[model samples]
Structure formats: C-alpha cells, structure tokens
Target: MADPAADAVVRQMRDAIMDTDLKLLQAVNTRLELVARLRAYKRSQGMDFVDQAREDWMHRYLAASNRGPLSEEGLHEIYGRLLDLTKAETAEDDPAG
Candidate 1:
C-alpha cells in the first residue's frame, strides 16, 4: 500500500509539470508565429531564412544564460532540435519554399 501523503505529493508534482509543459507549448507557438513574421520580412528584403551566424549567436547566448540542471550537451541537443523544428516550421509556412 502507498502512503496517502506521498501519493498526494506526487499528484501535485505531476500537475505542476503538466502546467509547465502547457506553458512551453504556448511559448513554442509564439516563437513559431514570430518566425513566420521574420520569414515575411526577410523575403521582402531578398534574404534567406536560414542565418547561420544568428544561430551561432543564439547558441552562445543560451550557453551564457544557462544555469542548469541541464548540462551543456543536453542544452545543445535541445536547442539543436528546436532550431531544426523552427526551420521546418518556417519552411512549411513559406510560400516561396
């Protein structure tokens, strides 16, 4: 049999985690919307959507800002995935692509 108190604590923690997940989803959507706008602006300026220098700068910024339970490698992995997703999302939305 489980301790009722422990079960209650676990439920609370799970709820908190779910809330954080929802917030992360909201943030991702917001970022995607901004990416769409950026794509349009860049298109008007006759520029490519993929900017390697900007991505490098972002990685450095995130590395500097991270005070993490997540290691550097973990951060890189996550950001790399994010960049890939962002590019894919932008490409899908891009009319020219």
Candidate 2:
C-alpha cells in the first residue's frame, strides 16, 4: 500500500531517468559511428588503431574537465569502459582484423 503522492513522485523520477538513459544510448551510438569513420581513415593510411598515448591524454583531459557529483574514480571507471567499448567497435569495423 503505497501513498499516492509518493507513487506519483517515483513515477516522475523514473520517467526522467528513462529519458536520460535514452539520451545516453543515442550519444554512445553516435560515438561508435564516429569511431568507425576514424577506423576507416586509419586503415587507409596504414596506421595502427590502438593509440595508447592518446588514450592516456583523453583520461587526463576528462578527469581535469569533470566538475561533478561523480568522483574521479567513477569518471575513470565509466570512461575506461567507454574506451574498451570503442576499441572493440572499431576493431569490428576493421576489414583486416
């Protein structure tokens, strides 16, 4: 037996979260698409896809830019996963691999 007002509040919060989740999904897909294009350009130039220095720079840059309720560790965790996912997606687009 939930209070009606509380239930409405919960529903409203859930709806907002769902909208944000959809935005995140869209952003990730857009990033993957850009990664695919970069992979193609690298392939044309015979360049290696894995750039460790660039990745390190990216993590540092993101950490510096973050002004957040999210901790540095949390930012690292999320971006680390994103980097892995991006690498995997780019690899999948590689014809030579």
Question: Candidate 2 deviates by what RMSD?
Answer: 1.9
Best by TM-score: 1
Each model's C-alpha lDDT? Answer: 0.91, 0.91
**Residues 1-97 of candidate 2: C-alpha lDDT, one tens digit per residue:** 8876579888898899999999999999999999899889988999987799999999999999999988999999999999899888778768786
Alpha-carbon TM-score of each model against the true structure: 0.91, 0.89
Clashes of each: 0, 0
**Model 2 error, position 37 (Å):** 0.3
Clashes of 2: 0
Which candidate tops lDDT?
Answer: 1
lDDT of 1 by residue, 1-97 (tens): 9976579888898899999999999999999999989998999999998899999999999999999989989999999999899888888868888
